[model samples]
Target chain A: MATGRIVIDVERCKGCELCLEACPQDVISLADTFNAKGYRPALLADPNHACTGCALCAVVCPDACITVFRDVPTPKAQVALEV
Target chain B: MATLTADITEKLVYQRPDALADLYTHYCPGCTHGTAHRLVAEVLSELGMQEDAVLVASVGCSVFSYKYFDVDAAEAAHGRACAMATGVKRVNPDKIVFTYQGDGDLASIGLAETMHAAIRGENITVIFLNNAIYGMTGGQMAPTTLPGQHTTSSPFGRDIKLTGNPIHIAEILGSIPGTAYSVRRSMHDARHVIQAKKAIQTAFEAQQKGLGFSVVELLSSCPTNWKMTPNEALSWVRDNMVPTYPLGDYKVHEELQSKRGRGR
Candidate 1:
């Protein structure tokens, strides 16, 4: 299976939480810490690589603070899993 | 999918549009102005019109649009964006010229300028942000304010009888024979945002091909002036605003579509 994640540019975020609402995977939330702009930036809650990289956050992000990346499952890893 | 992810740089699915500057804008958090600006910048970059575009910024909240978009910009007086855009378009016929205006500037003070330019069929594009309030001036009642909607000036809610009905600018402009394209789009959700971007792209193309005047009226939200949280404002636009300002294409010329090579 492919693993995916979202990267946020904290300094650019205004903590509007529009991305939090838009996230379908329920992986994003506002951090307790504030950015240079004095707004709490959005952070991904998933640490176990549960992201699907749907890019919904990027789509609704007004500040363009998010970028999505995915990890492709390798054939060797699949063979190891089968073993 | 697994084979593609091997390249790290290939993971770049989305980023800021190159047409946009890196500097920050002062718009309120969660205000749709930022989204609207991004849409225009993305479309301009997609069409490779960054250097050729001359943006005309009008008064009101959208006045800073010039600073946000990485292109030649000229600031227009109150409600005079279209008039200035007309001269800019006329002088530089080869350049793509468009005006970014808010409801207070477009439907109120500069109504005449917008109408006359549309009537004259000037080869220009207009991105009209209809937030239905005076955003920069403390949320006063605008010409597009909904019936019974309250504002700073209309503390008791807007009475259509007293202030007249909210102007349907898109429909009015669509009715003009000279208008090559006129459409209304919302910014409440991802679907509408995509549609809005497409509409903006088409509007710019209409001007690029020397088609008649074009206008893309975006139903955006002003969270700060509305006195609602950003999330609440987005919902308000989905509920209250969408009902009053239904989204659709009012007019699309055949010549313009043929150029884009699509029936829509």
Candidate 2:
């Protein structure tokens, strides 16, 4: 399975919950506390480690607050396989 | 299974496009104006036209659009964006000139200017935002407001007999001979959002090739004016707005038609 991570800029998030809806893995949720903007920011609350980092949340985000990254298999693993 | 760490070998998948300013926009929560701006910025960056682009921001909620885009931009009078864009494109024919206008400004007050620019084949791009209601003016009934839709001016629902009808800008503009490309897209869902981006990219390509006037009418939402949450407002656009303003390509020049259906 693809592994991934996301960074949410809390101050920039307006807490519209669009990222949560866009997260197919259901790994995102709104924080209980409010930010300086008085809006609850979305968090990468993945407990089962199920995030695939599809970037759907970032795509749907209107505020441009989410940054997404995907893990790449190490070259050492491919070298060992060839051996 | 292995635990994920921040230090893992990773590739960045998505981040803010360089064409957009690194500043907070004045748009409300869930306002699709930010989404539209982001898409435009992405397109400009992908086409490597950011340096040559000049944005003409129109009045309404998007009046501050110039502040959001990092490229050279100018603020135009209410309902005069097309006229100003025509001037800018004529003065600097080599530059990529475009106008960002709202329905009230494009279809209502500046209808004549918009049509004349298109009819003249001004070789400019127009990013038209149609949110149905006049957002900056406190949700008044706009020319694009749907029939029976309630607003500040139409508290009892808009009456078609009195207000006439909601204008289908894409279709109207597409019929003009000078219009090289005209299409309507929505920001209600991720799938449609992707399609909207493609349409925006095509509109810019039309201008880049000097095909003539191109406009992409984006059906956007106004959560504050609609008195609904951002998610609900998006659903409302899908359920209500999509029917009145159907999303499809109203026109495409024969040259551009060949480029359609190709994978990105």
Candidate 3:
């Protein structure tokens, strides 16, 4: 039940497509616009926001271009928020 | 769909390892050399051995490997990485010395140095990248090239009858009594990549304990040389390479076995 997202460093990504295949949720895709390096970089194209931030994409990323982030619960003044 | 939750804060789960340089590599797309380097950097960072580590960069596609790592490094002549590493480890004794080599550099030209180092029981780690072709030299055949596999030199496909079979480096090294640990792992998928990382960690640990020579032979990918897309090259490794070079620990020292528990 964890919500996660990933940021791809466009400049470093070579568009190898390993991340695309590695993503279990099929959330990543190649961008149409090419980066400065002329390579179409992978982007988080998750419409349903199904990413769980498993870091699998980053794990299989040969370029080490994907940075993964996950949402954490912050306990403070109790405000029951529905997500 | 609604869920009860507190204030949501984002935490970075994964990023580039500290030991790796913040610079672009010259490796071709989908080349697993970068993956192997990343794994080594992560291991060095995790073990807090960055400052005390010395990298011996070998010739080949990863010849500029030292520039990618933030550690004391030296460039060895072609196929002389293990021999150079022997000197470095002997001189420093306390430093963690390791070599990063390719198929041509290790299995072909450097075989003697590699075998002698292992036989001498040198306390050093070797990260051997075997992609089955001479990547830097325009994808020519290498000592580890698979049978019936086509390279520039083997345009008609490799003939095991004429050229002999692929040299199983890990198996040969594992049989050497001086080697503390020897294993072969692949980088074709996420699961296998993680397993490769673990094997690399174990190899380094073997060196850390002064056990002896440790080498982790990574069955990596070379998309450009293999004349296939990145994804296809990964599959090629799984379908073609894995069968030729089975993945497993060929040798694990008794002490390391005890430390890691039974069953790899």
C-alpha positional error of residue B84 in candidate 3 after TM-score superposition, expressed in Å: 0.6
lDDT of candidate model 2 versus the reference: 0.91
lDDT of 2 by residue, B149-260 (tens): 9999999999999988999999999999999999999998888888899999999999999999999999999999999999999999989999989888889999899645
Candidate 3, residue B82: Cα displacement in angstroms equals 0.5
Write model 2 residue lDDT over A40-64, tens digit each, in one string.
Answer: 9999998787999899998889999
Query: Candidate 1 or 2, higher TM-score?
Result: 2
Model 1, residue B105: distance off in Å is 0.8
Given candidate 1, what's the lDDT at residue B257?
56
Against the reference, the lDDT scores of all candidates come to 0.87, 0.91, 0.92
lDDT of 1 by residue, B57-87 (tens): 9998888888989999999999999999999
Candidates, ranked, DockQ: 3, 2, 1
Reference-based TM-score of each model? 0.92, 0.95, 0.95
Runs of candidate 1 exceeding 4 Å displacement: A72-83, B1-10, B257-264
The CAPRI category of model 1 is acceptable
Off by over 4 Å in 2: A78-83, B1-8, B261-264
**Which ten residues in a row are the worst by lDDT in model 2 chain B?**
B1-10
> Where does candidate 3 stray beyond 4 Å?
A75-83, B1-6, B258-264
Better of 1 and 3 by TM-score: 3
